[model samples]
Target: FADPSQAYDEQEASQEEERDGQYFEPVVPLPDLVDVSTGEENEQVLFSHRAKLYRYDKDLSQWKERGIGDLKILQHYETKSSNCAQTIGSLPI
Candidate 1:
């Protein structure tokens, strides 16, 4: 005699499997970075990875690293001043 709409559909499928097991699934897997810049109050972003450099803090959201080498020599320094003005235009101007 215990039918009552199949016991309220098995108590709403056990409260939707306990709200899908209270989700939370980060077991490492984040670095594929390559943003480049943002900060200056835009709340940080700056990533690069591999050749190093990473920021994305944004009030501690994550991805901190920051600094090592070759973020295209830190986001292009005019290609090292255009290779030092082509080595001073072959020396002469």
Candidate 2:
């Protein structure tokens, strides 16, 4: 009998490989946690992984991680307004 955990691991590895191929490295570090909100005042795209939330800094031309304590995100949603973009996430307290 095939081990369920092993099967799950293999499946996850295959999915990771597929994701890696689709998303170029260095550009998107964490694709699953990355999202874009497009509206009028440009788009607010962000990325997050584990406890760190990252935003693109135009002046620095780099992705900067925000230090907001140990944040455990259950889910995240990006909302766009006429002139702004917002990202809302469910974090465990």
Candidate 3:
């Protein structure tokens, strides 16, 4: 009788080959020009620190951990207006 294990291996190999044969084209063509805008491009970071934030709960009479993120103080180049931001990755928290 044919080795059951060998048959299973052959079947798996054929399935992998079938998967490799399939091709997918992009539904939409890539743009020639792409602008990488992060909104903070115009601004300059005055300060950046990795910190953990907390809030005091009056009802619970305890401190609650808000989140841990990069705390940044940004200042605009032209306007010179400064602001603080707590962000996790590229997102504001």
RMSD (Å) per prediction: 19.5, 20.2, 6.0
The candidate that wins on lDDT is 3
The regions of model 1 sitting more than 4 angstroms off are 30-93
Model 2 regions more than 4 Å off? 24-93
Better of 1 and 3 by lDDT: 3
Instruction: Give me the candidate number with maximum TM-score.
Output: 3
Once model 3 is optimally superposed onto the true structure by TM-score, how far is the C-alpha of residue 64 displaced, in angstroms?
A: 0.7
lDDT for model 2 comes to 0.52
Better of 1 and 3 by TM-score: 3
lDDT by residue for model 3 over 1-93, one digit each (tens)? 999999999999999999997999999999799797867887999999999888999999999998889998999999999988897655687
- Please give the CA lDDT of all the candidate structures: 0.49, 0.52, 0.90
Candidates sorted by lDDT, descending order? Answer: 3, 2, 1
In the range 1-93, model 1's lDDT, one tens digit per residue, is 898999999999999999996978899989988987522222222342334446698898999865554321122333322111111212311
TM-score of each: 0.21, 0.25, 0.58
Tell me how far the alpha carbon of residue 65 in candidate 2 is from the true structure, in angstroms, after superposition: 40
